[model samples]
Target: MEFRRLIRGRVDEPQLERIGREIAKRYDRESVRISVLEADNWLSTPCVVDEEWFVKVISPQNALVQALFTGARNLGVFSRGEEGFFERFEDPLAMSQHELEATRRVREIGLNAPEPIEAFGVDEFGVLVLEYLPEFRTLDELPSTEVEALASELFSALTLMHANNLAHGDLRGENVLVHGGELYFIDATNVRKDGLSTARAYDIACAIATLEPALGANCTVDLAAEHYDAATLLAARDFLDLVRLRPDHEFEATRLKGEIERRAD
Candidate 1:
């Protein structure tokens, strides 16, 4: 946790105040209330603005960390003899803009995504604003039974994403938020436009790893198969071991592999 904090860096109080002032200016408010969110975000400082806007204050360091992560993920894909798929931004503002566009695209495809507001640079930090969902629980915070009930919709949403030439790239518990009893995706990592197929499969693998702990291997595979065929699911097999290596994902890779094969047969 401490290491993560160091890598995420910090937005000092003065910078926070400046960002708040910018929000106030944008909304034509005399002042806006700002409160930092407790998140294990690797790329940006997330906060709520005036209780109405969800904001991310991204710094140069955050952009560097994002690039580093992208490089590492690409290397993982390369290890499996496939070209890397993840994309990286040049700087903080670009990172903010990319997320803004990605979130908007997700919403366009009939999925629940926060309404993207805008992206602007304040000093060296890039600020991203979006509509805030007042009450929400991350997928990880939900119980196993609740996760099971939501499994179909979750995979359904993922299918919608891939069918439309979109891929979440990063789909873990924290990125999947439950609000108003529906699944909303956030913090999508950028992937190569030409690599959507690989990205789609990788996303499926990540999704499987994410739900396996809660729904168990068989139930998770069954739910996934509702939208993906045996071949499509099999495409994700190469990324399973890679996804499992992520600390956020800890599932039975061997068990999932067996279930996926059984479904194929």
Candidate 2:
């Protein structure tokens, strides 16, 4: 039951191994190596194996991953389940098909994402291969200028994604990566297509929230106010308001908002 809470369901290692081996054979690789990234925890082991790239394996029993992969793929990202992995939990074939269709749409839009190499699902195994991005830093670790530049770029990308009727559902600090002076979105499993405006605004709020601490005293809300629109500001306000409501987040949000307001003066 505890594992179910973490991974959303049960996962069989043998099933995953079989699928990985099959995929390796299809790609003509010498061996399919399964490295368990996490075990004895709520989350299923996040594994990496030999292929043209890396495959992020999520247990179908995990509600969040399942929802994210399913939702994001529906909005146009490639996601699929491996064969013999988590088959008892859900329909892997349908999820994979939907993810492929989504990936095609995202590709058509020219958004930056890890190239989806292959996807397959059988039995309890489901796997998706994506081009690995090396030498990337999370938004929290970037320099102020780099963060600002990333904000500007994300602004443009978010606008484009919105215009094209897409919403990145989970826009969090860890999900953004900066490499080569460019911002790349990762973990796009929470994307949505229906509520573009709300989704874009939420993403902006999330980005601002993430960038504020890293920007420090030099970067204030007022400084950000100048860069964004009335609607965006409103959204940021709402986000800040929500943060203030949380006991754990109140101090940080208050400080950041004060800095922003001070910068305006």
Candidate 3:
């Protein structure tokens, strides 16, 4: 296994080697493909080692990964480790086990989701092997009309997840993929198996909020109204407005709040 070593901390070379070996061994492939993906704000840039299955593996940035996933930040000095910066180092395998299970569950339920080929117990690799759909495009790349259509398609996936008592804690455009006129949901890191949880509302709100860039903030409200009842729409609007008010990005919150209030009237 060859490690590109584009960024030192990004890919765990040893783990990558092990993963590659395991993949080759399991599949009886003689040669393995390896490539590096640059890091981005949304996800830890993972290396694509197996082109055949599109294997994306993240080294255990453990607590840091968890914090980023949950949008939680703390002031602390950075300490280097295999997983990444961590206040207290956590085992990568232990941390990623739940996520792997959640992702597999999404597939088991027949949602248009990634097939979790290999998940937990991959030797501290924290690897999430997913079926690669190269044709899928993010919501940002789609036009307004397609964005609205994708929004409706997303609602169907959301319904399946919620009906099974699963809430994709992170509901953003980047997490939704569209291919061959079908919508597929990915990134199960934040899934919670509780339909009744407030997180479900958050998912709906986040979905609508994420579509605002392409669909327009006001337009998304109407789009969501097509599928959701009055109460749910109201709840989604409230949540979307609240997210806009976070300290760093509160400029739009007041306007959104006023809009929601006026709509209620």
Pick the TM-score winner. Answer: 1
What 10-residue stretch in candidate 1 is worst by lDDT? 187-196
What C-alpha lDDT does candidate 1 achieve relative to the native structure?
0.89
Can you write out model 3's per-residue Cα lDDT over 74-182, one digit (the tens) per residue?
A: 1211111111111222555544455557777787778777666665446655556667776667665688888876677777777778777676765666667788888
The alpha-carbon deviation from the true structure for residue 161 of candidate 2, after best TM-score superposition, in angstroms, is: 1.1
What's the ranking of the predictions by TM-score, best on top? Answer: 1, 3, 2
Residue 148, model 3: lDDT of 77
lDDT of 3 at 42: 35
lDDT of 1 by residue, 1-265 (tens): 8887899898999999998998898779999889999888888999998789999999999999889888999999888778788888898999899999989889988999889999999998999999999899999899999998888888888778877877898899999989989999998654666788889889999999999988899999998988889999998977898898766677999999999999999
Q: In candidate 2, what are the lDDT values of residues 71-125, reduced to their tens digit?
A: 4323331121211111112444444444445455555688777667776765644
Q: Kindly indicate the candidate among 1 and 3 with the higher TM-score.
A: 1
Cα error of candidate 1 at position 11, Å = 1.4
Which residue ranges in model 3 land beyond 4 Å of their true spot?
Answer: 1-9, 12-15, 38-43, 68-90, 120-123, 189-195, 241-255
By TM-score, how accurate is candidate 1? 0.95
Per-model TM values vs. the true structure: 0.95, 0.68, 0.75
Better of 1 and 2 by TM-score: 1
